[model samples]
Target: MRQTLSNPPSGKKTIKQRFLKLLPCCRSDSTSPIIQNSVDDDFELSTVCYRPEGLDKLMQVTKFDKRELQILYRSFKSECPSGAVDEETFKLIYSQFFPQGDSSNYAHFLFEAFDKQKNGAVSFDDFVTSLSIILRGSVTDRLSWAFNLYDLNKDGCITKEEMTSIIKSIYDMMGTYTYPCIRDDAPKEHVESFFQKMDMNKDGVVTMEEFLASCQKDENIMQSMHLFENIL
Candidate 1:
């Protein structure tokens, strides 16, 4: 993807728009509950969130078959002892976590993720850049938790629909966690509402053109990567 913004200062922000750094968060820190929430356990979604390296570890080691359940079990052991799934659980239930289904869907998901312009097609860098965003928090917080949050359907890969919903959840979550830094309000809603209208061509889609037209930031992308830089 382009390392630079889509358009220059000579432009606008698209529709009702809203808009990672990582930390080696210690196992425990008690400044505030949200900060404290940074702690990890296997079952907790926070623990599941992971960056590129971690995702690579996950994809590399994870079994494509029944072995998935075992890993889930370990996560539960680390994070939640009370509500773990039993050995008798079916594979389909676990399937819910794999948000992207087959190869085609994975391709689509990757396309959206890496498509810097949002026109939908994977780029080498945008696809890889999210690693920085993913690595911004504890393993659980970045992967499982982020996954769980974005995977509204409980499926593993975040779909375009899921992405739309999550864009909102992302803001709400940020406001909640960084209440002091950023006031609590519907910033995500602002962004989404704008995007909906910016579907100006009525294509039922929003483009990077529409997006760039809308934000004040020099770089109007999701800016998730900043978390890694900011935290550091």
Candidate 2:
């Protein structure tokens, strides 16, 4: 996986495209309201095999056996009181982990990924599976997730406009404390550098293949992707 950054072999599917195929199959519509003030009761009730089929599938994807899954679900339900966590709630909760409570951009992208159904909220199932990937998935899995985060339009590619927008949002999330007090032109410069290395064919757009290739070869990028690991 650490060869030169280049187009994947023809006929070999990009990880991002393959991941997109799996996304539809993985989504769940579990809208059961969170049992507030009943964590113990919820644990007891869960022992009876509620949503056995769904739980089975979740375990299959997450590799978290019954006990671990139950523990995570209990924790998730405790935080998401309404059975689902809305973006605002997620942002607020996620921000608390940051030194300045300024994780808005990262949290926004993470919430978007976890909200698999694009329904403006994250269900318990959604929370568990996505967290599993972030916590334990392989590098390829993490890269696919990163690509999904940057491909804001869901069009299977990243455009210059999207890169600029995302970078701007990240800077905005940093508030006034963003170091170096970078110039106004910094975002464009960053976007240009990204395209220079990642666009491959200079088509003014970056396909998932290119993004994966570039990131895979860059040790710093790979390391940075796991920056939140300790906090998590």
Q: Pick the candidate with the highest TM-score.
A: 2
Stretches of candidate 2 exceeding 4 Å from the true structure: 1-49, 95-106, 224-232
Give per-residue lDDT, candidate 2, residue 128.
Answer: 71
Clashing pairs in 2: none
How many pairs in model 1 have backbone atoms within 3 A of each other, for residues 3 or more apart or on separate chains, i.e. clashes?
A: 51
How close to the true structure is residue 48 of candidate 2, measured as C-alpha lDDT? Answer: 45
TM for candidate 1 is 0.25
Candidate 1's residue-wise lDDT over 1-232, tens digit each? 1122122122322111100011112112454223443434324544443355655554443322222323333433443344332221312322232222212333233234434455433332332344333433443334333344344454444344665654443333222223233333444444455445444565544444443343324343334323212211
Tens digits of lDDT, candidate 2, 119-221: 9999978877776776468888877877787788789999998888776665554444434554688778878877887889899899988888887998866
lDDT of each: 0.34, 0.65
Off-target runs (Cα >4 Å) in candidate 1 are 1-164, 174-185, 188-190, 193-202, 206-222, 225-232
- Model 2 Cα shift for residue 44 (angstroms): 8.3
